[model samples]
Target: MHDVVIVGAGPAGLTAAMYCARGGKKTLVLGNTYSSQQSMGGLYENYPGFPDGIQGIELSERMLAQAQKFGAENQTEQVEKIVPLSNFFRLKTENWQYEARTVILAMGAGHRPLGVPGEKELTARGVSYCVHCDGALFRNKAVVVAGYGNGAARAVLYLANIAGKVHLLCTREKLVAESVYLERIKNLSNYTATFGAEITEIQGDDFVTAVGYKVGNTPRTVKADGVFVEMGMKPNADLAIALGLEMTPGGYVKVNRLNQETSMPGVYAAGDLTGGRLQVATAVGSGASAGISALQYLG
Candidate 1:
């Protein structure tokens, strides 16, 4: 039996593995780190210690290497279920089952898709969910931000600096971003916001060339090189739910902010799974907290 078994291999899981292994615990990390949403991000300028910024995939690799160097074992397997036993937890995967004294759930959130035609076909080509990842690729080209709320407004602001022009199509009556973001968006000369607009389709041959939408009863098409869908994200909490862990109304695992401990004993959750700002820095911090708490629990 291992001392700690962390499900998920994103930044939070990797960081927890590094700490747990360094603390002399037998740590095992399940799932592929490269498959995380963090890895989908192209370049990260917000993460600290990287003056020149780092690619999301490169950062994930470094985290995995660091954890492995500290004696944490890793397996790329999808966990089917998690069973809480008398004093330990049993994690069942397709190939194997693991018993651990402590468990950390770091399964990240999945992006809510636009569900528009051509979006799937032109994903990497020009359609992206993360503006920070693909906005730079559309430099000097017009792009469309589809959705409302703070995420959509922030995406528009971020893309406005990189893309030649930014068009925001909001299904809501008005943009629902923070006042600061809304104010900044208004100052951008190349940014245009269309309220009460619904995206009908994403059109492109090999890449996204235009976005089809409707404003009220009028249909419209905007020329663009890229489309950013920022509707939001949904936490991946199937295992947590199955294990009977307490969760927020938004479907994220509920954990103590101090120690990242879940409602169930010996179970913890961190990162996007615990809700809050879904950023690499926050994930790393929370993972560290969970690792330390698990180590303390083992003692």
Candidate 2:
């Protein structure tokens, strides 16, 4: 039996692993292979302590390496279910099962698809969810954004730096997000805001060619290299839910603020799965909290 079993490999899980391992707990981190932060191309500039910025995958590697150095074990597996033990927890995967005295849930956010036609098949070909990773590839090209939230606004601002022309398509009546981000997007010459718009379909023969949307009473087409779907994201907390943990109305795991403890004893949660502000730095802080709580519980 392990002392702690963390169910993700994102910033939070890795940070937790580092702490638990250093505290002399046997730590095991199990997570999905591709959906984690590393698949988003690893470039993070906003995280603290690193003024120069770093790649997303590199950052994940660094975290994993640190945890390894402290004697944490890593595994790639899809967690099927988590069952409570008399004094511990049992984690079940497709191929294996393990026991742990404490658990940390940090599955992070899952990609929220546009749900429009041709979105799935044409995902990597032209449709993307991450602007920071794919924006540069469309440099000097035209692109369309499909949301009006802060995530969409940030994507537009980021894509504006590379794309020649960016069309902001908002599902809502008007642009309503952070005033600072709204102001920045509004000031950009290459950025064009289209409120009350919705993407109907992504048109492409093999790759993305253009995007068709309805603006008020009219239908319009925007030529584009890609469509950056910044329409928010959903937290991947099904495992936590399946295990019967208390969750917020929006499906985020509910935890005690200072200790990151869940309603269930010996169970803790952190990161975007716990759903506060889904930022890298905040996730790290939450991970530390969960790690310490797990250590305390195990002791």
Candidate 3:
């Protein structure tokens, strides 16, 4: 049995493992950290101490290395289920099962895809889910923001500041976002919004060159250097759900703001699973909190 078992290897999970292992707790971190959105983000400019910025994958690798240096064991297997026992918890992965006195759920969320033609083929070529991650790459180039909601609006706004032109397409009758964002979008000359639109395909050969959509019966195409899909995210909280943990209305695991402790004792959640900002920096902070809390629980 291990002292602590973290269910993710992303920024939050790695940070938690680092702290737990350094504290002399036998910690094991499961899951592929590179598959996380943070790693797919490409580059990060907001993470502290890196004035020149750093690649997301590199950052995740560094965190993992630090955790391992501190004696945190790791596995790349995906956890299928988590079972709560009388005292400890049992985690079942594809090939093995682990028992731990304490558990930390750091499984991050996955981005919702457009599922349109050519989108999958040109993912890194020109289509991206994160504006902050790939926006800089398309500086002064035209781009299309697919979907509607606060996330879509944020993508439009962020892209507008970088791209030469920003097109916001939505299937709804109206765009849904905060009043502040809506007001800001109106003042941007390079930003355009079209509601009641359905994306049919993403066109490109080597890189994204255009997006095809239909507004009512009228089919239209817009030239774009990049396509940013902001359809929201699906949090990997199935294990948390099976454990009967309290979650927010948005389906994120609910945790104590002060300590990242979940509704259940000795069970903590951090990073995207706990929701909020959903940034690498925030994930690290939350992971640190969860680690310290788990240590205290053990003591």
Tens digit of per-residue lDDT, candidate 2, span 173-204: 98767787778776899988778887888899
State the lDDT of candidate 1 residue by residue for 1-299, as single tens digits.
99999999999999999999999999999999978988876667679999998988999999999999999999999999998889999999999999999999999998889888898999999999888767789999999898888778878888888999998888799888779777888789998878899889999999889999998879999999999998888899999999999989888999999999999999999999999988899999999999999999999
Local distance difference test, each candidate: 0.91, 0.86, 0.91
TM-score of each: 0.79, 0.86, 0.75
Cα lDDT tens digits for candidate 3, 1-299: 99999999899999999999999999999989878877876556679999998988999899999999999999999889889999999999889999999999999998889898999999999999887777899999888999888778878877888889998888688888779778988889998878898999999999999999998889999888998898878799989999999999999999998999899999999999999988788999999999999999999
Q: What is the lDDT of candidate 1?
A: 0.91
Candidate 1 vs 3: which has more TM-score: 1
- 1 or 3, greater by lDDT: 1
* Residue 196 displacement in candidate 3 (angstroms): 7.6
lDDT of 2: 0.86
TM-score, candidate number 2: 0.86
Q: Model 2 residue 3 lDDT?
A: 93
